[model samples]
Target: MTNYELNMKYYFAPLEGITSYTYRNVHHELFPGLDAYFAPFIQPKQTHVLETREKKDIDPVNNSGITLVPQIMANTADNFLWAAQELAARGYDTVNLNLGCPRATIVTRHKGSGMLADLDTLERFLDDIYNGVANNGPKISLKTRIGKDDANCAQKLISLYNKYPLPELIIHPRTQKDMYTGTPRWDVLEDCLRISKHAICLNGNIFSPADHQELTARFPTEKYPNIKAMMLGRGLIADPVLHREITQNRPVTQSELKRYHDTLFKAWDALNYGTSTLLHRTSELWFYLGCMFKDADKYVHKIRKAKNIPTYQAAVEQLFEHCEPGGYFSAP
Candidate 1:
C-alpha cells in the first residue's frame, strides 16, 4: 500500500439505532484503528432540547476514550444551533449534520435528502448554520446524498458545498431514491473530488480491505489528494477488523471474531431492558456479521429465526461450532 493510502483518515459512519455509544465503545475496544467515530443523529426537538437517548449518546462520560462527533438531524437553524452549542458544552469540538438519510420517514419530514429537493432552501439552511453555529461553536461537517430523486443533484450539490468553508464533507454517492439499492454513483464521487473545496470522505459500498484498495486505486493519490478520508458503516460491523486489516495489515482470526461477538453480546445483555430487545439488537448485528462465516446460509437462517436469548445463543454457538470462517457479502 502507498503511504498515502496508509495515511488516509478513516471514520466509522453513524448508523441510526445501530451505532450507539455501546456499540462504538465495543467496536473501538475490539478493533482500535478508526480515527473517529460518529454517533448516530441526535434528533433535536423544537424546544431545543435533546431526547434521553440523544443525551446519553453524546455524553462525554459515555464516550470518554474515543473521539466522538455528534450528528444532528434537523431542518431548523435554531434547533441546529442549540444542539451544536449543547454538544460543544459537553466537550465536543465537531458536529456532523445528517442530510443523507434516505429513509421515507426522514425525507418526508423535509429533514434529510428532502432538503435536497429545494437547493435554494438548502443553501439558506447552510447559510444560517455556517453564520450562526459553525462560526460560534464547534466546526460543522456534513453528510449528504447527491439529491432527493436523481444522481444529477449530486453534481449540483458539489457546487453548493464548495461555497461553504466546511471542514469535512462526507458524500454517500447515491440519491435518496436509490436507498441503498443499485450501484453507488462513482462518477458523482469522482466529480466531487475535483470540485469540492472541503475534504471529501467517500462513503458507500466499502465492505472489505480489497474494496478499500480498489477504491483508492481508482482515484490515485497524486491526483485526487483531497479525497483523503473513508467512512465505513455496515462493512465495519460485518468484519470488525476491517479497518485494522487495511491500515495495519492485521488479518481477522476466527477466534478473535468470536471473542468480539461474545463481548458485544454480553455488553448488550447487561444494558438492554429485556431478552427481546437484546435479541433484536444482536440479531440485527448478526445480519451483517454472518457474512464472515463460510456456508453462512446454514446457520444465518437459524440466527435470524431465533426468538429468544437462549435460542439465539444456541444458534450462535452452532455457527461457531460448525461453520468455517470466510466472508459472505462484499457490501452492506
Candidate 2:
C-alpha cells in the first residue's frame, strides 16, 4: 500500500537471520497485530541464493497473507533494480532497501547504511531503481539511518527522497556508526516529519507499551492525527507478546508467556535445524527476553549454558515459574 493511503499502523523492521519465515509464521499465529513483516535483506548478484537462511525468510508460499517486504542491500543502482526485479518475480508487492543495517560485517562491504556515506552514488542508485529498470510490480521502501556518522542535518537527504514518490520511508535516526549505542534523536525525527513529503514511520529504542503510549501522546494529533506506525526491532523481540499486551492494556499472564515460550520451541522443532542451531536461535532471544525477568543476567547465563533442548526448556520453565516481571528498562 502507498504510504499516503496506508492504514499506517505497525510494520515490523527486518532483523536478519533471527526473524526468519519460521519465526514470522510462529509469531503471527501466536500473537497478532503486525500490519506487515519486512523480510531480512536479500543481497544482490548471488545467482544461487542471496543468504543462507534468508531465502526461506522471503519465500512467498511460506509467507502467505502476510504483507511482506523483502529488503534489498546493494551499493549500485543496477543491484537495486536487479534485486527489486528478483523479489517481484518471487511475489512481493514491495521491496525495502537496507540503508540502515549498522552491523560492522555488513557496513564493511560499503552496503547497508554505509551507502549513505556517498550521497552522490546514493542518489544515482535511487534514480536507477525508480526509473532505470522495468519491473512488473514491487514498489520500493527505504529503511535508512540518519547519516554515516551522525544525523548530519539530513534534510538535504530528505529533499532527495522527496524527489521520488516512494511507498514509505522508514527512518531509524541513528547513523551506521552509532549502531544501537545511543538514543535516536527524536528532535531530528521531528524535523524530518516537518519536511518529509512521504508518510514517515519511526524506529529505534521503543522498549515497552509505556514508551509507545508516551510517544503517541506527545505527537501532535491535530494535523497528522492518523499518523500511527512504528517499526520495532530488539524491543519486540525482548517480549514477543508486547503487541498483545498493549492491545489488551494489561499485563500478560505468566501462563500466557509460558504458552508463547512453548510455541517458540514447537516451531523450532518443526524445522530440520540441528539441536545446537535451535538452542542457539532461542538463546539469541534471551537478550531481548532477559529484559522481562528479575534475574535477567543469570537467566541469560543459564540459557546460554544449556546444550540440549530439554535442558534449555527446563531452565526456561524455571525462570518463568518464579519470575517477577521486570520494569521498562534497557541495555547500555
Candidate 3:
C-alpha cells in the first residue's frame, strides 16, 4: 500500500434497504479494513419515535464491536436533534447528517439533496440543529452532494459548511440533476479539498484499487492532508474485499466470496422475514455481486426473475457453479 492509502480511512457508505445491521455485522466480521460503517438514513417522524426496525438497526446490542455511526435524514432541526440525542444516549458520539440522498421520493419531501435547492432554508436548518445539539448530543458530520442541479454550487455549499465546526464533510461530487450518471466532478472535490475547513472524504465512482490509485495520485495525502477518508457504497457492496484489496494488497478468492455469501444468506434467512422478502433482499445484493462473476448475465437474470425461494436458490447455485470471479465489476 502507498502512503496515501495507509494514511486514509475507509468508511462503508450507507445503502438503504441493503446495509442493515445484519449486513454490517457480517461484513465487519469478514472484512477488516473498514474504519467505520454508517447506517442507512433514518427519517425521524413528528412524533419523535423510532420504529422497531430502526431501533434494532441502531441498537448497540445488534452492532457490538463495530464503530457504527447512525445517519439522520430530516428537514427540520427538531427532528434531527431528537434522533441525535437518542443516539447519544445509546453511546454514539458521532452522527452523520444525510444531505446526499438523491432519490426522488426523499427529494420531493424537501429532505436530502432537496434541502440544497434553497440555501437560506438549508442554512437555517443547519444553524438550529447545530445549536440544539451543541452541548448534549453527538457531534454532527455531513454527507452531501455538491448541489441540487449545478456543480458550481459547491462554492456556496463549502462556504456554508465552513461556517460550522463539522468533524468531517463527506462529498459525493455530483449534482442532484446528475444523479449517479456521468463522471463525478473531481474538480469540485479538489476545490473542497483546497478550501473546506473540515476534513473531507471523497465518495463516488470508486470501484477498484486502480480507481483508488488514480484518486490518490491526483490528491496525494502529502498535498491534501485534510482529505481524511473515502466512503464506499456500491463499490464495497460489489466487492466486499475492496478495502482489503486496496490497503493490504490482497485479492478475494472464490471460496472466500462463496463463504461470505453463504454466511450472509444464512444470517438474513434466519430473520424469517418470509420467502418473498428474503428473495427480494438477496436479489438486491446480487444486482451488485453478480457483476463480479464472468458471464453472469443469464444467471443474474434468472436470480432476478425467480418467483419462489426454490427457484432463487437454484439460480444462485448455478451462478456459483458456472461463473468465476475476477470479472470486470463495474458500478451500476
Model 1 misplacement above 4 A: none
Candidate 3 lDDT tens digits, 116-229: 999999999999999988887789999999999797778888999999979999999998988888879998889877889889899998888888889989988788889999
Total backbone collisions for each predicted model: 1, 1, 0
Give the clashing pairs for model 2. 238-288
Can you write out model 2's per-residue Cα lDDT over 127-241, one digit (the tens) per residue? 8888854455578878888888778747877778998767788988888777887788778777777788887778888778877777666665455543457888787776776
Candidate achieving the largest TM-score: 3
Model 3, residue 315: C-alpha shift (Å): 1.7
Point out the higher-scoring one by TM-score: 2 or 3: 3
- Sorted by lDDT (best first), the order is 3, 1, 2
Candidate 1 vs 3: which has more lDDT: 3
lDDT (CA) for every model shown? 0.86, 0.75, 0.90
Using all chains and alpha carbons, the TM-scores for the candidates as numbered come to 0.97, 0.91, 0.97
